[model samples]
Target chain A: MLKFDEQKVKENMEGALKLRPQINEVVDQIHERGFSNICWLGIGGTYASAMQAVVHMKEKTALETFYENAAVFLTTGNKRVTKDTLVVISSVTGSTEEVVDAVKKCNEIGATVFGFIDKAEAELATLVDHLISYPLNEQLKFFMVADRFMYLAGEFDEYDEFYNEMDQHFAQGIVEVEKAADKFGQEFALKHHQDEIHYFVGAGNQWGATYSYAMCYWEEQHWIKTKSIESHEFFHGMFEIVERDTPVTIYVTEDSQRALSERVVNFIPQICGNYTVIDAKDYDMPGISTKFRGALSPFIIHAVNNRIDVHIEKINCHPMEIRRYYRQLDY
Target chain B: MLKFDEQKVKENMEGALKLRPQINEVVDQIHERGFSNICWLGIGGTYASAMQAVVHMKEKTALETFYENAAVFLTTGNKRVTKDTLVVISSVTGSTEEVVDAVKKCNEIGATVFGFIDKAEAELATLVDHLISYPLNEQLKFFMVADRFMYLAGEFDEYDEFYNEMDQHFAQGIVEVEKAADKFGQEFALKHHQDEIHYFVGAGNQWGATYSYAMCYWEEQHWIKTKSIESHEFFHGMFEIVERDTPVTIYVTEDSQRALSERVVNFIPQICGNYTVIDAKDYDMPGISTKFRGALSPFIIHAVNNRIDVHIEKINCHPMEIRRYYRQLDY
Candidate 1:
């Protein structure tokens, strides 16, 4: 019956050094097992985390990482998992029924399961092969899922340089995110964001995070039209359809890619479209550079989800959380 | 130089045969070359085709297909291309400035080249390893960019009975698309769709087509918010966001998926979202089934670009033919 604390969560994230080895071991096990195919499954931020991990690891694992949407992982019936599969379950609560069902099937089909969960005793944890314990709960998000997850991976994977960079990035990113959030009022930007369709653009590893943190959540929560494209692809003819009114957002990951990011940011004003962009490099964080992984960029993107949600709520004239359980779950 | 006859265009679409083998063949070449890792470059529909083709073939080829936007592909100063690759040129007219530059550089890089062109003698025709010819200029879109290039693998590759089914699907598909287009402007649907934000959703192999078509051209051209998503994924959470003001169009692809399409259609009304859906199987052509190949489904989605633009104009009160531009080629 233990829950999460916004402050404690923050402390854990702000000081993720404690959980490093736990996370490292998990990433290592999965990496060593080398499941040619992987399905990262979960809900909300957990789902987003799975995406970030895949994005970071993608250059390494490529399409071997698949985000399994709970509703339709099954091709026919009862027979969903494949033998050459590694199922990674991510959930702050480890209570999502879909994740539970998915993991069970994966086990049935003889697939290995790897996950990071808050509680070792959670049902979803039972079906997993390597369950890395971490602090997740309602407060997990407030603690900043990005920093915590990144640190966990760093401690375990021993990417010393990357860890150090991520640490620097997080400490600084927190302040910048707060400042940006304050500037993100509805009339100023959210009004603009909510009313039109949006495209979330990023390049390399940052693209997947853009998909989850920007495209999927924004579209789902607000019923706003949000699509994502990576880098220069948006300019291919898509540039023509972009009018002065079109709102596009670019995810900036690091200094090296800043030029590429800036190139796109600079083009929007000229491309007959209006845009709001976030530069992760400029984001106040402790050591963000090392955290830049092909599969890991989503974590950076996740760091911004709430700020965006806050602004979206301002435009929506509603609270940021979805509270309805009126309709019973279909399954 | 051919102009369009609305009546004939509509009628001929009915008579058009499914070019699945041709489409699949083109995809196969893409797949084969893709196995070796090639950079894809193009402009306009060619770019769109390149994007869809690369995305479609990624599952089979892994990370080989790269969608290069015009600015980077054509105008780059030699950093992007190398000898260990191939370049696919897709332009109906084969004369766009960026398209030309992309092909020339690849030739300079000694990368194998492939072209899907409307005119055999088009400038890009001189730049490739293999050329797939089409009457794209007369057919409608000169850039065979989306239709042929996007579909090259599917169309030019070896024929399959399934491909025949796909052809029958396209012929019949045009009719159903027309029907969907006809319903687009109803006062009820218009209140939602025409209001500045448009969204489209489809799943499986069709994800690319739905995502690209709605997100790219539909959203792009109309100066509205548009989006596409995999169907089952939406239900995982987006369903609750549906409200009366929301308007949705679902692309129902094949016999196996018809019932699933209907279920979603039924849900749209129940959730109070304004919606219009089309079944590809409803097309005038008969016997073909809509099947998916990894990321390849977007090719079919690309084929419907004209109808999307046409319908946007028909509903938004724009003139019959919005002469945004007509490309007169130097070639």
Candidate 2:
């Protein structure tokens, strides 16, 4: 594997798994305290992750959950948000200005805020009422919280079974997915590294991943121009731009919305000669149940797509951390 | 004024305004019937338009409102939707496959549906419980329904006055906006017609206009590659790709979230010399009150941007109505 560190990957996954106990404890406390609804507030990548969680919540649980962009939420506050709202936020640096300001506003509104931050000393960690500092797999952490909340609410019956399965094989399963995906990722990176622009499409729970990877990784990290649309929306406005030689990538999920992406897959080949389909069902997850696959597909898809990011970074000779305007010079 | 028909636009705007009496009648009937919440379901351009309405509703009303992509809503139904839910939908042709299917599902759920369709004989017009068959200026129609609902609920006290003022100035105001914007639009089109791609940024009420114009107009209608990002999210990932020569257009709104776009305005000129700012505050609305500008900015901005579309259509020698794959091909 090119630039792959197997040990570090496993260690990071295991480390994220270790936070399950803390996550459970926090969720239990929040559940005991009672909340009118759940609000996930974030910006950019974090915002996209929160959107995936909210989509999952809509599918499995009847819990009132809202996903909001931190900055937009700050400007146009939701009437549903109140003292009884349980606000969940995440930040890798724990210092995204918008998320920090939003957390402050949530605090002023007397809402209980639980944040997933990478550093305990970060500003967001200090502001949040409850903070989880181990942030390796944010999607998994959010699922754990949502699953626990559902368990307490008598909505998710497979909570213990799900976590128990994850304990046994989650880390290794992700590694397997990455390994399976690396070959295709390298090939894709080699082929499309110099392409002017790419169109990415996904539906269901994978929409957030598709959106974030296209903008945050491909555009931000590699400076590649890209357009991402929901699979259902691909036929709307985006389809007109697809020519025979246009490069298109479709992330097909294993959820109920698989049909939506299948529609795209069936349609894209008819118009686009250069196209790729990354299907979640193509990968094998030995321990995770099919019933929970839809809920966990975002994480699976993320792990699988990480290979592409690494390969693209290597192919383009662009360090994933390089930025020209973001935090490099003051705006 | 190339390809511009001032008389046609005025007539269309006035024709749309004429539907207000029928719109008010339908909303009044729905008010009497009562609804638990309002749900706007649409796809692509209509979805973006509904999004703007939801954004406005958030700032002005305490009503429980939802904006959802029709296809996604069909796959993963929201728990908030119920028999008492008011589902608002709009379709120009009124036979969009996913929208038609979603309307059927909404009907199965027994939710009261109000639809805006251009043709009385359209499939959707026949399906919806209450249908308004005049579809010019959809944003205005959506706003009118929203305003009426809020008025009946005691959330909008100036609804009558607002409509009265719009009736007096809205049509001519839009014409004035188009006239004011033509020169700039022609200049912009002539300058950027040959550019490889464009990056559009907008915030608050103008985000939908920005998104729809970039995708539905630029990409779908004109086959031009473009990327649109919300102003707040631009700083997240899109900002990294922007250079001194990058062609960026920022839509600045007059809403509460104006600060979000202002932040981008304050930063873009320093980095990108080719950036253009389309501020909603620059246009004057003589008879309309400043209090309603935030709610009306989407319509105002849409009218202003029409000039750009008209000019670009003429410059590129590509008819906006021509599509290689939309309805011409069966996917």
Candidate 3:
């Protein structure tokens, strides 16, 4: 619990929940205007976030959704992004060069682009057709958008019930998740913070969280070397590198592909002495239904990972915000 | 080329070329039967190969193509795949558990499944609707399928010309590529064979090759720890972790996203003194058009990388085919 801000975490979750009405209003406008397909565009962490939503849509809905890396999209435009495409994008800084350029390209293509920006005065806020300034809970905002679209499309019958449950329990449930994870996260950091390299494995929608946490948090924030591989992919080639003492972390979700990670969990411990399993099922979500757990696994895993990051920063005596090259020197 | 057999490589390349007529015949039947969409399924290296083809299809053709990891496809079925879906798969052993299972699942869904197997008696060959017994050049076969489909759909007008040029030049062109790359590859392996972790960066179509080489060749074959990142993604988070002497290799391709990798190539030298650029443009493909270079960059890069693998295997004194777990242990 070192350096953990309980009050701030609560406020951020509640604040994001409060954006439901605005999110619904924006989604309503999108529904009214109509779109042929949905395109989620982002870069790095945001790209990983969008990928989680796209994976969910692919599983439960018939909606045509495309997840693209903002930089790649900016450079080599997707043929699917026609005037009728609905482009959904997000940027924490609202000034990520690639995302901003991609948003402009989307507009030039006559696509209806809506974006979530952290600052109303940011360049991207001004560029997008519909801009929602929400500073926290990016994954939550993305789910709201995806769920609302599915609801309107008659693909999600539990839409109202799910959100109602979320309204009543999500903030408290997530706080409990963080509290539950704090001790383990601290212990994990204490044990493996100095490891030369870490291998992260996860499956289903949680794959995005696995990927982002390794790149955005471990490597970027802590300046650690890491490799993030999907659970199934881990067996393909990466498994050969695992020794008895190699440090590995596998995330187990309640999603349909849970068995994939379970396979890794089952296989790794037999070969690797240093391995950790961060299972979403271990954290209680209070009143949330089991049916929705898979859909919400990314949020749960990310909240748990945030605790790990905090402890890693504290343990390593390295401020999470410190960067040597990013925005520091000309590339 | 410490362990490379130039004559063997020539035979393999020419053998793959000779299969072009059979590849076209299979593709013709697929065209005649007609499919609403294309699904390329594989695991590990094959999955990476399929991704390169999908990226190409996305750029040039209006075809609805889905690239999926075989395990994930088996566990969580994609809604886009149906009876009219054309499932293209590959397996070297023809007994990859997840791939065999995925092909069965595809069959159950009544989809038309065709596969490339190294042996005619392989399990996957028996299961698929159309079986192609090809022992080498998996990427070339994939390209043939993609290009032929595009040609039939009228999206690629120069397909015949491209293949004609390839028929005339591909085998010799690739041999020359390997010869050109031998010294550099050997030097790279000798210089960095002891490095704890190597970072690989590539963009566009070459991204798949980058990912596969790091996992399949470095990790699986040599038991080396490495991280493979896309060129654009490197700037986002991974760049922050790069030190002055980090061993970073950037694969610069002739594709549209070449600038993305070029940016990495240009920036890395400024920060990191130990860096390598394996640019596809540097390799010559006799009689092949400039327009075809981008599409064929993966092949050129792979041929270049094969030399690197040979030298790594030689310097490390670890046979590339040796594995502690893969098919050797009950994991």
Error of 2 at B193 (Å): 1.6
* Candidate 1 TM-score for chain A: 0.70
Q: Give a tens-digit lDDT track for model 2, residues B114-186.
A: 9998888987788899988775678889988888888888988888898889889988998898888889888
Report the C-alpha lDDT of model 2 over A152-222, residue by residue, as the tens digit.
99988888898898888888888888898888888888899888889899988899889999989988999
Global lDDT of model 2: 0.87
Highest DockQ, which number? 3
* lDDT by residue for model 3 (B147-258), tens: 8998999989998899889888899899999899888888888998888889999989888889999999999998988899999999889888888888999999998899
Better model by TM-score, 1 or 2?
A: 2
Per-residue C-alpha lDDT of model 3 across residues A25-131, encoded as one tens digit per residue? 98888888788889888889999988888877877776778799988887666887889899998888888989988888988999998888988898789899888
Q: Each predicted complex: what DockQ?
A: 0.19, 0.75, 0.76
Model 3 spans with C-alpha error above 4 angstroms = none
Q: All candidates' TM-scores?
A: 0.69, 0.97, 0.97
Candidate 1 scores an iRMS of 7.9
TM-score of 2: 0.97
Q: What is the TM-score of chain B alone in each candidate?
A: 0.60, 0.97, 0.97
List CA RMSD, all candidates: 7.5, 1.6, 1.5
For model 3 chain A, the run of ten residues with the poorest summed lDDT: A1-10
